[model samples]
Target: MAEEEISQISAGEFEAVSQLLSSSESLQLAFIIMILGIIGIVFGYRKFSSWVGSQKFYYKRPHFSRFVRRAVLPFFAIALITAINVHTQTGVLFGEISSIEDETISAHEQFAKILNTFNILVIGYTISHLVPIILTKREKSILEKEDFDAWFELRGFSDDSEDLFHKLYKWVPPNNAPEDIDEKEFQELLNTEKGRQYLEQFRTSKGNPIGGYEKLVDNPFEEWKKSERAKYEKYYQNCITGNNQSGRKLKPGTKPDEIFPIDVWREEKREHGYESLIPSSRPPGYAKKKREGLPKSAKQILPLGIFLATILAVVAWWGVDLIVLATATGGFSIGLGLALQETMQNYFAYIMIRKDKIFVEGDRVQLETGYNGYVHKITPRVTYIRDALNESIAVIPTRQLVNAQIVNYTKENKLVPAVVKVGVSYLNNPRQVASILVKVGKRGMREIVDTRGRHLVKQKRCPYLDKNKPSCGCDKELHVDATQPVVRFNEFNDSSLDFSMWLYVRDYGAQFKTKTDLRMIMYEEFKKYDIRIPWPIRTVYQGDEKKEFEEISELDPDRDKVIDEFGMGDIGRGEGDE
Candidate 1:
């Protein structure tokens, strides 16, 4: 029986070969078509890639063009496979051909299915890459247009969506409705579908859909009350947690029970709320309200979207049951989690740092561990700080930075406070010394501020009168009452009276120069005033000086000669020389 079955299979294979030999012409034509199609696909892909690379949008985003180019090969492969299958099945390419056996047809179908699955994977991957690029481009367009409403809509806010509930059930006047329409006419117009659709685009200040009437459906000022309450809540929480977004802690002796007025909290938040990655060209107090904005949000969401799509595609194409897939996914996830625990922690910390506006690039920060520097760059895992003291880049892990105490000297204002300590003799009057210190501080402040102001005017960046002018009285405009130089009598030391001269410089970088200027000025002023800066003086009493002199004479025979040459005859005497 086995021999008979084998002989039958062999006979079937021989018959299939004979049929192929009978249609050599069709086979050659099919082979020629495939070869030409492949050649055309290759040439077309290169041209398309070049064209895409040349376009302005893709030129700016080379990665997007690369992704597009990578997708071309798989796309052409699918197209070629489809063309071959169609010509084989329909015989339209030749218009006359020998019949293909069921076995051959079945094999082709199986092969096509496998290729199609692979094509789907490639297409899905391409889509994943393109989604972020598209989103980024859209965000850039909206930003360039300065269309905040479109941005809000892209973020899925209700301000851009139609209020279905108000449109159907409520009847109120749209905020933007024609003022000419009377109550009666407006009501009549609302009965029509066109009027309703037209009015649907407008909304009341409270975010309700505007209807036929001119009045709002809800209390117009209720939203303001809710907004104020929310602000107060956040302010209260921030105060309690000491997370003021500036990375500064509350001053010592601050009353925990003291709650600032909502207005004060609102103003504070308004001042410190937004941080720009680069310096803005806008005027001061023009709050940006958004940081990296929609582009960053899209970048964050795209990764997760890609991850979920990949898992779905795997399950769909591989025909794996959900239960087995879930089990394998769980084990894989556990292993990945364990391996990337520290990395994930740092990434999340980086997110927190960015969201909270703790500190940004170019901010001068002093860590509790004595690492003081300007933040050069911030990455997912590490923050690079150019050390101010050593002029070296310090790489700190994001997780460690988030947990460490940081003093952001340039957060609220660029002006940094500098102190110059001076010690004067007790004979000098404290009031006189204080006056001299204040004069020195004021001199230093004027010199530095004038120099900086002149530089700004040269650069046409002075915020005073005419920016283009060489000097527009910027000194008066730049001066702040709070930053005026002051003198503090801090403490009394053994040698002299300690006093600190405090003044503000233009920025953290200017503080060192300002301090040096103050010290030099103070030195000259003290000398002119005859104010003595006393040094520590010690008095020593020697008992039995004659015996001490005898021991010295025994140790060195040339003691008398050295004393005669140096005129030190009084060294063994009781008289003291200081």
Candidate 2:
């Protein structure tokens, strides 16, 4: 792949392209026409290219053409494609529209239309991230198994765990020296420059005090665990779902109680009330509520807001396009705008979203329209996302981010763990998988599962496992070796099945690369062992020919004949087959 990329495109190819554009008659005519009419399309591209050049992307180099197309195409394409779809659906299928309105496309289609606009915005946001900037890809080598394991445990771009507690702060109280040396002599060791340097990288990142610092921030995790109210809040906040383990839906307003004393919690939900009409899910219709308006995650006046946003975007582009083009030739009529109202609306919404930071570069966002991943870039009205699969980046409208439940792991904190939940067939050992996963994850991330942090999670009764929930695998789901680790079988799925366990890793910075490597390991292991990773399959038989079958069968007959002739011992003789 690397070779193909380098060999296919080079300075020579670029020069050829330039020469073709400059000398070709069609290109020359096109240039002349563009210079006379729609000059903004030409000059505006250059201006935007210049503007883009000023912004620095750490890694990727954005080409002028890529910049121009991404920026301008949305302003035009959104309105144009939307117009085509709407015009066709409205005019030609006028009769069928009413008949098929309910089921043919359903409410989801209309929602899809709205989402398409928003998806464009998401695409625009993602493009920025794809434009790589400066990156430090320095590698640290570890030879010893323990060192490698330690590196794995702390692979995340985070501080060492102990250093957080053992922050070497100021006012170094001299260490007690031997009776012959005395305390003053030991103070010199504390004053060394080397000791101060050690404190900065390890101590500061861990939020520790430098130079024998005594200041200690109160333990937030411990504090939360102690308070009765805190425990209940956490129980609900850290609620485990079957998607991660069990597929069972906890009773609405479910809280820890029957297992633990009710008094243990300061307050638990008494009524199964839906907290928000909107669900945290990215898809629009996925909201938990059955209501008229949009999901709570969506801006309150969802559909209307989307419609209005569309109009605004169309206006911005249409107006600018009209004014700019008019200066060179003629203006577009108001009738054009009216005729393309819905199209314009979608375009307008697209721009409005891109202008706002509803989601931007590096934000991990899931759009209402099915696009989900880290925002790679935002240009004009479309945003791009490097989807979770990391296969190909998806482009969506910025409006989609606004309309979707934008889950920003980095917005608040950068340490987001890309979770991998494993579910196996009946009677399969989950403990083994868990151990394998931990080892695999640590190896990939060079980080460790914070066993020390394990003690922090002390629940009276583990909510992860229950017999009644369907999410909990059938009675067959077994977690026999969980005598120590907080591992459990929570639920079942169609193909294989589910285990949920919270792993403490370095943090978010290490998460992407770590998870990627771990997933690769999983794929290799699965393939090597002939394990079937669940996926949809369909078999197509191109009418087998009896003649073909007979011909092949005749060639293999000697195998069965050999077996018949010499019993099982004949198998050893069938090695070389030309």
Name the top TM-score candidate: 1
Residue 376, model 2, lDDT: 72
Q: Return the TM-score for each candidate structure.
A: 0.46, 0.28
The backbone clash count of each candidate, in order, is 2, 83
Ten-residue region with minimum lDDT total, candidate 1: 456-465
Q: All models: lDDT?
A: 0.55, 0.38
**CA error at residue 275 for candidate 2, angstroms:** 47
Q: 85-149 in candidate 1: lDDT tens per residue?
A: 66555645435554466554443343335435545665666677666767765665444233233
lDDT tens per residue, model 2, 262-319: 2211111111110111111222222222222221222222434545555545435323
